[model samples]
Target: RTVTLYAPASGIVLEKKVMQGQAITAGEELYTIADLSDVWVDAPLREADAGVVATGTSAILDFNSYPGHPFSGRVSYVYPTLGEQSRTVRARITVPNPNRLLKPGMYATVRLNTSAQSALAVPQSAVVQTGDRAIVFIDVGSGRLVPRAVTVGRSGSDYVEVLTGLKGGDRVVTSAQFLIDSESNLGEAMGAMSGMGTSPQGKK
Candidate 1:
C-alpha cells in the first residue's frame, strides 16, 4: 500500500525534514515551504527620520545583484521598538517578486520618500561636529570664515536641515572646512594667551 501526502499550500520547498522512506509517524515533520510571490524587506530608519516614515510610504530598494534595477514597494509595517545599538527604527517594506529574483537575506539599499517642505539646508560636508556641538563655517566677508554653531534637524543623503544659526542666503564653506576650523581654534587660543599676558595696569 502506498500513501501520498500533499502540502497545505503551494510554494517552493525551502527545507526538507523527512527523507524517502524515513518518516513513519502519522504527524511527522516533513518539509518547509515558503511562498516567494512577495517578500518583506526590513529597512533601518534613522532616529531623526522616524517621524517622517509611516505606513503606506513609498520605498525604493536597490540590490547589488541587479545593479541599476530598482524595486518599488510600500511601507507595510513599522516596528514599534527601536534598535538600541543602531538607534534606528525598523520599517517593513513589502515588495512584489513575481519572478522570484529577490531572495531572502539579500542586502539592499532602501530609500524612502517623505513629504517635502521648504527649509534652510546646507551641504552635509559643511557641518563639522566637535564632539558636542555642530558648527558651520560662514563666509563673513573680507576672506573671513567664521565658525557658527547650528542646530541641525533632519538629514538627507547630501544636505542636512539647519534649524537655527543660518539664513537663506548664507554662504557656507563646504570644502576644506576641517583645516579652516582648526586654524580658527588655534587663533582663538593665541588671542586668549595674549590677553593673559597683559596684567592689570593699576596693579602692575
Candidate 2:
C-alpha cells in the first residue's frame, strides 16, 4: 500500500518543518505554505472612524520598501467589536499580488475611502480631553477663548469629527490652548468662589 502527502492549499513553500522520510504523528506540523496571490492587510481604525468605513470600500496602500508605487485594495471585513486595550476597530483589506512582490510582515500605510456622509470636522489640536468629556475653546469675539465641552466622533491623524456642541464658522483656538485651558479653569474657580465671599445683600 502506498500513501501520498498532499498540501491542503496550493502555494509556495515558505519553510520545511519536518525532514524528508521522517516519521510523523497523526497531527504534526509539516510545512509552512504561503499563498501570495492575494494578501490581507489588517489595520486598526478608531471606533469613531470605523463607523465610516465599510466592506467594499476602496483603500490605497503604500509600502515603505517601494516608493511611488501605490497598491489598490478593498475592504474585506470590519471587526464587530472595539477592543478594550486600543479602543480601535479592526479593518481587513484584500489586495492582489500579481507580481508576487508584496511579502509578509511588510510595513504599509492604508488610506480608506467610503460612501459615508461627510462629518463636521475640526483640527485635532483644537480639542482637549478632560476624562470622558472633550473640550474645545471657542472664540467669542475679541480674542476670548471660551472653553466649552463637545461631543467628538471618528478622527484621523490630523482632524476630528464634532458630533455636537460646535457649529460652522466658529473660530476655535488651536495653538496655545493648553495654557489658556489652565487659565480658564482658574478663572471659573475664582468666579464660583467670588460669589461665596460676597453677602446675600451685596455686603462683602
- Could you say which candidate leads in lDDT? 1
Steric clash count of candidate 1: 0
Which window of ten consecutive residues has the lowest lDDT sum in model 2?
Answer: 195-204
Clashing pairs in 1: none
lDDT (C-alpha, whole model) for all candidates: 0.79, 0.78
Reference-based lDDT, residue 63, model 1: 93
Cα lDDT of model 2 by residue, 1-204, tens digit: 458989999998888999877888997979999999999999899877877888999999999989899999999999898899998999999999989999988989999987767778889987877568787766665534456679998777898889998888888767524533455443552343345321111111
Which lDDT value does model 2 have at 100? 95
User: Residue 176 of candidate 1: its Cα lDDT?
Assistant: 32
- In order, what is each prediction's RMSD in angstroms? 6.8, 5.9
Deviation of model 1 at 45, angstroms = 1.8
lDDT of 1 by residue, 1-204 (tens): 689878999988889887787847888778888899999999998887888899999989999889999999999999999889999999999999999998888999999988887889999988877678887767666655556789998898899999999998988877634443455543542343344321111100
Candidate whose TM-score is highest: 2
Off by over 4 Å in 1: 1-6, 23-29, 143-145, 179-204
